[model samples]
Target: MAAGAPRIFVSHLAGVAVFDPNGDQVARVRDLVVMLRVGRRPPRLLGLVAEVATRRRIFLPMTRVTGIQSGQVLTTGVLNVRRFEQRPTERLVFGELLDRRVTLTETGEEVTVLDLSVQQLPARRDWEIDRVFVRKGRGGAFRRSKGETLTVEWSAVTGFSLEEHGQGAENLLATFEQLRPADLANVLHHLSAKRRAEVAAALDDDRLADVLEELPEDDQIEILGKLAEERAADVLEAMDPDDAADLLGELPEQDKERLLSLMKPADAADMRRLMAYEEHTAGGLMTTEPIVLRPDATVADALARIRNPDLSPAHAAQIYVCRPPDETPTGKYLGTVHFQRLLRDPPYTLVGSIIDDDLQPLAPDAALPVVAGFFATYDMVAAPVVDESGSLLGAVTVDDVLDHMLPDDWRETEYDLDGTDDGTDGTADDRRDGTADEGTDERADDGTDGEVRADGA
Candidate 1:
């Protein structure tokens, strides 16, 4: 939904038809999934539980939902047919929250929740429960009684947030909700195995995928091993193709094949293609998904594609201009159009006309050192990898190159806020002591100091 999209009442969404971009009805909304925060803060709208034509209830992540209008929901058409399984941290708005009695913070009066209003946060894709519709005088949601009805902000009521105690994984997740995936992975690394698994299971697939990419190999394998095979496949599918391939390569052949068989055919094919290459080579390190554009695509089109919030900085730094068939393993690789050039050129300019084909692209078999040299010599954040037929395979970003260059234990190494090595094993005690006096400094730097200590403490 857009920033100024009208707020939607949960009651109005119940049983609403869900359509794909083509306007075909695929499912109906059964309930809304939300994650309640630590305090009086608004609960985030996670997604919807939708029942498909086959009567199977599936999870439709809010990210996949393009719009909610005219009493119907529209999706990006990328539906995951897997059954909806509520995580420990997730709450069902219709099934769990509505009709519950909660205390109004100001009046100390108990009101039964009739509905909740969700609004998209300005300039962000996230939606939150911003208002609550309730009735007073001890009336139930269905019961007809003479009670005053009012709408109030989510923060005006109590009892919606998770309790501070006994919500192990849920509370832990809420506390570190704002932490970056890498920082959260670091916290998960120091946790006990059982606790780690609990937290990992509670996380949604997209969140878990991002965190798994940041975790060490052993940790990644361990966490993936604990999830149900179907969910493991889903998480893998959510991950970047290169990262997914790297993780699958670590698994036993049979296990790897099983998960691959479970994934979408196209994603699995990308995984197989990536896994076929040497682990440290350009093909292995490159992500199959890149900003690819046809020769005739305009600068405006390139800018819009790169503006996707999902793209990494490196991936968005430039666009690979190709012949027809823009999806990677794209037709004859034309050239590149750097973002700066796009900005300097008129919106109507064709990317092909301003192409920079001076630098040679990397071959799939290019070794790690060769890939590193390409990035260093050209000062490029990302470089294209093309096959013998001159078709663009994928693009390798500098971060993937750095990940290969660094020691295996690089992620486990402790560092101070100033980027200096702390010279201590990254243990709970070490982390707690490191932040004893420097918590403020760490917070100012990354806003994760208190969260880090909270996890370790």
Candidate 2:
């Protein structure tokens, strides 16, 4: 290590605490951001992506970093609470660069990037990539094992870029991983068909499911059509049944059946139920995975589930209690316990003792309008879905209900040339009204032929 030139591997910085000068912890390093440059120049280190208590990520500029030691980062106490937004030139180091393959020009060997070591450039405030830790050649499996490791100057390796600068698909896939699923789907939507399929093929099942759920029906079908039968089934299995069923509903009957046959029996059965309901109905909007407890479950159990960071806001609002056959929701539906009630009760109190029987659950067959009215009248964010047998089936969240109520073509619409989006929407015939002829020629309702006069004229 060069004296007075402090350096830390990016991997070591993951989750390192960020503290103010007074030693009060503020946040943890979620990721490192960098700016890729042209002509083999090392990407300049931008700053840290700090994750706050709310799990929201914010940018911490490099200038604020006072020290990096004792498994923690010290900041200048100055901070910005705004959420981090990526600039076009910025890339997240861990998400976009680490674990990707790069080639060593001298040995013509490919290696996986394990971590990057960065240090401030001499006589300058700027921090730059100094070296990289790479794992070299095991070459037996899809994910290469770490055989021998070495640290090399950043310039000795290649294949890191934000844009298409003759980089390979692996590099592009790395950048894609950094995008949120919706944004990633938009990128896929614009790609050449062949390239889109290539990118789709590169993603794992869960990632593919997330992206597929965000895409339009046409794009969803196109991507699924290009995937192998088994892979497509896997992707569907990873999706929420409602989303999977909706996508499957768009396929031809034979294709849908074949794909379903390839899926796990339980998942396929759930999809069947979801597909049977009208798309805008309560049954269709509900998810089968809401947290469930039996009557004997204690308040402690409910609080634990609610405390789970992964629970969605609506799902965390209450805990459902049902009768036996609990593995699946095939038992008698008892009632639910709201989160606030859990906090009020003793930890050992049985959930059944304080069940909110006054909270009416939704019937699976309830119409969309009825579901909307139920939520509005009761001020509920989520309602349990029960079947005619009085068995717990699922819980319909307000988000799903509201989403189903949106215009079918909402995702397809775009802002107009004047930066305004609302209008008499254009139709398939490229006319505001479907009855108009498809011609670009402008006509006017003037007394004279061939022109529309200005309002004043």
Top lDDT hit = 1
Highest-TM-score candidate = 2
Backbone-clash count (model 1): 0
CA lDDT of each prediction against the hidden true structure: 0.79, 0.73
TM-scores, one per candidate: 0.58, 0.59
Model 2: weakest 10-residue lDDT segment is 427-436
Stretches of candidate 2 exceeding 4 Å from the true structure: 1-3, 12-41, 46-96, 138-144, 158-227, 250-255, 289-356, 367-369, 376-381, 387-392, 402-457
lDDT of 1 by residue, 67-112 (tens): 9999899886655554556666667775557656789999899876
On residues 261-317, what C-alpha lDDT tens digit does candidate 2 reach at each position? 999999999989888888888888888778889999999988988888645689899
Please identify model 1 stretches exceeding 4 Å from their true place.
Answer: 1-168, 415-457
What overall lDDT, based on C-alpha atoms, would model 1 receive against the true structure? 0.79
Candidate 2 TM-score, C-alpha based: 0.59
Q: After superposition, how far is residue 344 of candidate 2 from its true place, in Å?
A: 8.4
